[model samples]
Target: MSKSELDEIINRSLELRKKYHELELTHHGSHWSVEEDALAFLTDAGLVGRNIMSQQERWPKAHSASELEHKIGESIWWLIVLADRSGMDVKAALENFLSKTEKLLDQ
Candidate 1:
């Protein structure tokens, strides 16, 4: 898909997330500055990776595949939120990441 196409989707997803979690965010004082939000995002990212290991180890008592999926989405949302908080363009960042990875792989 085109960069703008992905951007449109990210925009809508962010809007919907804010609408759905507005009250929860306000209750938890989640309007953190860029650095704080980025750190929080990193924590969520860690959960995503931890959940992957849990799944591999068949440790579903606490972490299931569903939890893994949820954490993955949450991690992605964290990236979007952190980028937005920093006034960075999520689409551009994604494109740059893909380019860098492709180059590294000699694609």
Candidate 2:
């Protein structure tokens, strides 16, 4: 995808996240630290993982391919949110990671 596409996705995710936090505070009586958000992200990841395993086994309630794709996107949203909160430019960080891994593989 293009940078614009990535930017759109990240921007939307941040917007929705802000709304979600407000809902949590107003309706759920929630006051979550960054650490708590991280843990919840992990839980979402686990759900995605379980769906993958279940699909591999052809079991009931397994995520359809589209659902699985959406779940992966959701996990990425969490990563972006966490990275941005930590004052990192996640797109640049991803590019840096790719550069390092590519060089290591070429060595």
Candidate 3:
């Protein structure tokens, strides 16, 4: 995907995150802490791993393709949210990471 497309996705995720925080505040009187967000992301990440294992037939519990796809998308959304909560621009961070990895591999 183009950089603009990726940035758009990140922006949308951030927008949704703001709405979610509003809900959290209404229901619980505060937004989740960054650590809580990290934990939630980790939980989804674990589900993604489980889904992959199921796809490989290594896991006893079976997960549908849709479930795996949803989890993967959710994990990515969490990454964007995490980056924002940590006061970083997700797009810049992603570009920096990719560039550094490419340069290192080229060496």
Model number with the top TM-score: 3
lDDT of 1 by residue, 1-107 (tens): 87678777688767965774676577775654567657877888888888888877844546677888988887787788777767888878888999999999995
Q: Rate the local accuracy (lDDT) of all candidates.
A: 0.76, 0.87, 0.95
| TM-score, model 2 to reference | 0.87
lDDT of 3 by residue, 2-71 (tens): 8889879988999999999999999999999999999999999999999999999999997699999999
What CA root-mean-square deviation does each model show from the true structure?
3.2, 1.9, 1.1
**Per-residue lDDT of model 2, residues 1-107, tens digit only:** 98899999999988988988998899879956789779988998997887898779856774588888888888999999898888999999999999999999999
Best by lDDT: 3
What ranking emerges by TM-score with the best candidate at the front?
3, 2, 1
- TM-score, candidate number 3: 0.92
**Cα misplacement distance, residue 107 of candidate 2 (Å):** 0.8
Q: What's model 2's overall lDDT? A: 0.87
lDDT of model 2, residue 2: 89
Mark the regions of model 1 whose C-alpha exceeds 4 Å error after superposition: 1-5, 20-30, 58-62
Name the runs in model 3 displaced over 4 angstroms: none
Worst 10-residue stretch by lDDT in candidate 2? 58-67
